[model samples]
Target chain A: MPINSKIVRRIGDLARIDLSITDVDMFSEQLGEIVDLMNQLDGVDTSSVQEMDSEIGNGHENRPKDIVNEGNCIELILKNAPETKEGFFTVKKVIE
Target chain B: MSDLASLTISKARDLLSTGEVSALELTEHYLQRIESSRNLNTFCFTATELALEKAKSCDRLMSSTDRGKLCGIPLAVKDIFCTQSLPTQAASKILEGFVPPYESTVTERLWKENAVLLGKLNMDEFAMGSSNETSVYGPAINPWQDPNEATPLSPGGSSGGSAAAVAADLCLAALGTDTGGSIRQPAAFNGVVGIKPTYGRCSRWGIIAFASSLDQAGPITKTVRDSAILLEIISGHDKKDSTSVRCEVPNFEAALNGDIRGKKIGIPKEYRIDDTPAEIIKLWEIGINQLSDSGAEIVDVSLPHTKYSLPTYYVLAPAEASSNLARYDGVKYGYRATLKDDEGINELYKRTRSEGFGDEVKRRIMVGTYVLSAGFYEAYYQKALKVRSLIKRDFREVFSKGVSAILTPTTPSPAFPLGSKNKKSPVEMYLNDIFTVPANLAGLPAVSIPTGITEKGLPLGLQIIGPAWEEANVLNIAHRLEKDSNFRIKPKQWWTS
Candidate 1:
């Protein structure tokens, strides 16, 4: 499906990127090209090829030993910040 | 002391161990060189006093007989990896002022080995660019001299800082993360040696995740032996990183000395894409010649699904990154946007993220979110995952057919100009990773070794890829190539100029 302005606006807003009108038009064209390229995959015969997540084994199913508190010193980690408040970084107010 | 900057970590350690040179003196020499070469921009933050202190501490350890392989050796940690005392911004504004309370596992390992911390090197924001120009700080200039190429050249990203630092002698060697070709591409551009070990070999506890599935921290150094020694110190299992394998880590130092007399090396047919430069093709041929001369048999192999690598990588890496970066919302940790009287949580998040992430990073997150969205998952992400398996299967089949390793170019082209993409579309730049992304998708080990230079004087790299946990083979061959090749090149005087 071609990316219309509505989809472009949704993606731009969701991504929080400030895209100019020029970028929107360019990106629309690019997205169309990408979708067209992806459509080529439709021709491949995957009747015998079983879908797999990883080339390696599916290690995600088997959980490893639980050891949650492996993080390092909190004080040293926050030492070189430009701004922080109560262990959290502070930035310019993003919304009204 | 003039040649002090050019000495490899192996040579530096030998000299430092014998008390022929003090660690403080060595650190001062590089610090002075860095101060003079402001054009290189190799370092994002040069912690001179901290480096001296670390060197002094290593000196004490050396005097007390607790010296390890890297004792008193100064090395830079790529800014993407957290360092306890230095800024760990990962070259992005969102991470500004964010320093980790603890060092990354890899950085800690380097410290444990008594490798003196030089400082944090610059990189593309979140390890994203092919050229180092995407860095928040500025592009790191290629230290190679080329009168024809008067403009500053990019030391390839996202590990451009580490590669440039090593190339310019700011540090004997440095650590860099490879998600796609970050380490290898920069290593090639800077005319150095870099290795991205097989996935799961190195722990990724604190390296900022660009794409978790593809990210592996590796060493960028002047020679393959130095890379091996550094890898020996850094590659191992860390419980904090669950993806790290618990298998016994081989002694890469010892493996480097192994005989390659009867090794079967495969040259991948697919890596030679259309419009591949004649120089890069020549570099690959020279690499084949070198390996054949070293008593290794060469065979032509094919990775049939190679063309699908860039698209698959774009999907998978962004999908993983989108999930990984979700933690950076305004509330729990870094980059919280101050809420106004009327703004809701959603608005705050949108504002915070908008202000925090760079353009490329945001684009990736959007791409990732789109592909992984519930409705599109089956069509985009799942199919990409399936194609990923076919790509990996191609490698497994060829490797099982008795090919020990695959040879390819780390990039289709050498280092582009620092601002080459100012006018080029983003996809044009993304296509540069086409050659290097396949190994990442397959989770195999690969190395970039400086083979030769273009007539323009930019260094070219020969990529050696191996099966899972075959870093030993990769490093051995790269070492042999470096030993035999007449490429005794160094950074331009701009490094000292």
Candidate 2:
């Protein structure tokens, strides 16, 4: 099935990236075939196969202990931010 | 040591231990080489000042018996690895001029071993492309060019810079991360050694995340033993990455005793697809005979789900990449787009991300978001995960039946001319990673060692994959094959002149 241009635009919005009309047209054509290729997975019967998360091996033994820890570099942490004011990240106001 | 620039880690070690060559002298030689070979565009950033200072320190420690194995050696770091106070852009406009205040665990360990930083090497934008064409800074040209045409051949990627630097002899060895065949495929194209150790073997702390599950760090070097030496230094447990396995690091170099006698090497029949080139199949057969001649028991194995690896990798890698790349908002680190009067927070995010990401990256994020969206999640993303399990089970069954390693071609064919393939869409590009994805999906160790040069006089690679955390056996098999094949096809030094 053709992945509709509307679906592509929705995905682009979901990903929070703006797309020109040209990109939507081009990407929808490409993504449609890629998603169709990915649909090949449906042919394989995986009824009893347990999903593997690479190294995790379907187990949670590697999870670190939960504890609060302080990082040493607050100034450095704020160093790369585009807008920082009074030691807090600043962004455009969400509420009027 | 007349030709200082071409020395390997093991060769350089022998000379350094005997006080034949000072570390400072070695660093200066490589710095000069990096500058002279500027035409290749292999090195995106280099630090002569920092390298010399560290080389002096390395020289001072040479007198002590407690010196580390990599003491006084110079290495190129991929831009994807965070080096404290140095630019680590991953060759993307989004991360242009972004310097981390801390070091990646892998790089920190290399520095602790007294390895000199030769500066950051070029790569695909966020490690995304099979060819190096997608890099924002421009492609890192493969040192090997076809004889007749001026058109540059690709070095393969996203570790293209690492491979080109090693093949060009810019550094002794380099570190590279492979999410899906980045290390191995690039190494194959460049005629060198590249290995991607099992996932959880190297800590992911400070390394830029492309795909969290498949991304792994390993070494790219000139020889198999050099790869073993570097791998031994870089692989181990780390508290910083929780997924890092807490096991004792093995002596990988010592394990390369050239002893693969009575070992079962699997040749997956599924790897021989109909469309695969005869030359590549011939090299695979040669690799089989070479190993079998060395007393390894060659067994025909079947990974029935092998054909679906590339499609599954595309789904899973992108899904994770969409999540990992979400942090790059204009409010945080790296490049931020200029806002217009009407733009608010949502607009800022949309514009910043749209401006920051390249075409390929944008394509992936959209594909990823589509799969994870509410309606299609069950049909695509969930289905891909289940298929991944079957691919892993294929390896488990073969390995459990006493197969020490699986031998196959590292890439479908030798290096094609850059821009010759992948002109229309990414399907042809993604297909290039077919043979090398199963090892990543299974979290197993895989290496690409040059087997022979092609009819076009380009390098080809044979891959050896071992079960999880059994890099020792895999390295041993590759080491034996290296000696048996004795395929030493070096690129003509056209770029250096």
Candidate 3:
């Protein structure tokens, strides 16, 4: 499947990255080539194979009980924030 | 003091135990070397005061019987690992000025063993690129130079700085993360030893996420024994990381008895790709002979799904990266673009991400998002997952056949000159990870030991990969090969005045 500039633009938007016209043109070509590379997978018949979700054998069974093990360091959590107000992360207003 | 920089962790430990050299003295020597070799661009940030303070503490603890394994060893880390209060930008502009509040489990363990932090090393932005060219700090130039070529070579990445620092003797060893061939490939290119332990061997807590399932942390060092020591210290179960297995942390260094007698070593026939450079093939043949000479039976095995590994990796890694990177939405931390008066939150997100991420990172995000889109998810993501199963099964089958480990070339070619990679085609660069990616897909223990040099005096490495959680087996074989190869060549200190 050939990836067109239109599709590349949509992917950029889905990823929340603003792409320029030049970026769309370039990614269309580069991603097309990469898709061609990925197309090689179609040759192998994986009809009987199960999806490998993770390399490790164990699942979330190893997770500790659902409890708040860590907290109370509001200052540390907010230290790297771009904007903060009164112990809360401040972002651009979402509601009018 | 200058010569002290060349000492390995093992040697320095002996000297420190005897009070022949103080920890502060050793740390000062490495600090001086790091200062002098700034032209290599290996370090993005230097924690000079922190290192001196840690060294002083180690010196004070010299009288105590409860000293840790890596006490007073001055080491740097790939900027991907979060270090509290220190800049932990994963060498990307998106994470500029982002100091992590917590240290990564691996680094925390290292500090528990009293390892001193030299600073944070440069790497490919988000650990995305094969060459260090994608780094926000610019390319960390390879200390190894081709005499005939005027262009500087790549140290290979995303652990480029870790390998370069170890190669240049700027530090004893450095921590590096391997997502695809990040650690081993760079170590091969820089004539150093690096081992990516089993996927869950080290906890991923506090490390910047790239591909959640694929990333594993390891050490880049001057010797195989040094890597073994560091791996033992860093490997253990972490409840913080559910994927971190509840396995025994063996004394990896003690397992290096150099006895591979009667061990069955498999040579996967499919790795002999047609485009592989002749030097790499020659070195691989040499490696096979060395292992066989040590009484290990060399047998030919097949991994038919080997060709599919790289494509599967490209699809799946990006899919996970797209999801993992969504946290950087210009709200909480890192770089946030200045917004216009009328710009909405969505616009802020798009602008910040667009302005912050590099070309390669954006390319990956685009690819990942497209693959996981509703229309293409089944075709790309699901298919890649099934192929991943086959790849894992291939390794499992080979291991079940009494084959203790698999030996292959760590890379198809030695380090190429910086900026020589074709910008138009990204797949060409992705090919560098071909030989090393299969092990990661299987979550196996693999080590790259510097075994030979190319005709141009550049280093080449032979890899030994063992079954999952068998890091000791992998390191033992690597130690045998390291001793037999006697690869002691180091790049000249051209950057020093």
lDDT of 3 at B113: 93
Summing lDDT over every window of 10 consecutive residues in candidate 1 chain B, give the lowest-scoring window.
B329-338
Model 3, residue A1: distance off in Å is: 2.9
Worst 10 residues of 2 chain B by lDDT: B416-425
Sorting all predicted structures by lDDT, with the top scorer first, yields 3, 2, 1
lDDT of 3 by residue, B264-348 (tens): 9999999999999999999999999999999899999999999999999999999999999998888889999999888889998
Cα deviation at A73, candidate 3, in Å, is 2.0
Candidate 2: clashing pairs of residues: none
| Model 2 spans with C-alpha error above 4 angstroms | A58-60
* Top model number, lDDT: 3
**Candidate 3: C-alpha lDDT:** 0.92
What is the C-alpha DockQ of each candidate?
0.31, 0.69, 0.74
lDDT (Cα) of model 1? 0.80
DockQ for the candidate 2 complex? 0.69
